[model samples]
Target: MPNVSKCQSLYSALVSRFQSENPSLVLSDTISSWLYQSIYSIYETSGEEEAERYVREAHMV
Candidate 1:
């Protein structure tokens, strides 16, 4: 699992990329909240190394 600080950084990067994909609008609050939860789920299920790799592979790291 990722530490809080690392998770925060990864979440920000993911959200940024998500928003960038739709320049005209951002994700809904509901979806954004889901994203935060979803990332943590990945970290929890996959462990630190794989989770970090998951984000890094997406250029989030």
Candidate 2:
């Protein structure tokens, strides 16, 4: 599984892409707070097994 920093970087990249296409939408603190919660939830709930599964699935793709 990727470390927290790596995940954060990916999240930032995703946010950048969203902002680029939706110029009128601004990513404020609230948006970031929600994103953090969502990301952490995925990690906390799925744990290592799910992460490894996802990695393998991605490799197949």
Candidate 3:
């Protein structure tokens, strides 16, 4: 846990929450489309073209 910064942990927790909340939504074409929509949604909200460094790093876990 120490290796993960606070931001990384929080980001991961949010992602985990999505998965945990909808296990049925976590796979297949459904998830693919959701991920696509999410990509746009994230950028729309954050105005960022790419993921933050901590998000990229924490995703590896």
What TM-score, computed on C-alpha atoms, does each candidate reach?
Answer: 0.66, 0.56, 0.37
Candidate 1 overall Cα lDDT vs. reference?
0.68
lDDT of 2 by residue, 1-61 (tens): 4468745654565566566667776767997777655555565677644543433333110
Q: What is the lDDT of residue 13 in candidate 2?
A: 55
**Candidate 3 lDDT by residue in tens digits, 1-61:** 1222433444555467566666664456775455445544554556342434323433312
Q: For model 3, where is the 10-residue window of minimal lDDT?
A: 1-10
Q: State, as a TM-score between 0 and 1, how close model 3 is to the true structure.
A: 0.37
Evaluate residue 50 in candidate 1 and report its C-alpha lDDT on the 0 to 100 scale: 65
Model 2 residue runs over 4 Å out of place are: 47-61
RMSD, every candidate, angstroms: 4.1, 6.9, 10.4
Q: Pick the candidate with the highest lDDT.
A: 1
By TM-score, is 1 or 2 better?
A: 1
Candidate 1 has its poorest 10 consecutive residues by lDDT at 52-61
Give the backbone clash total of model 1.
0
Which pairs, if any, clash in model 3? Answer: none
Model 1 TM-score is: 0.66
What candidate 3 gets wrong by more than 4 Å, as runs, is: 1-27, 49-61
Better of 1 and 2 by lDDT: 1
Whole-model lDDT for model 2 versus the true structure? 0.56
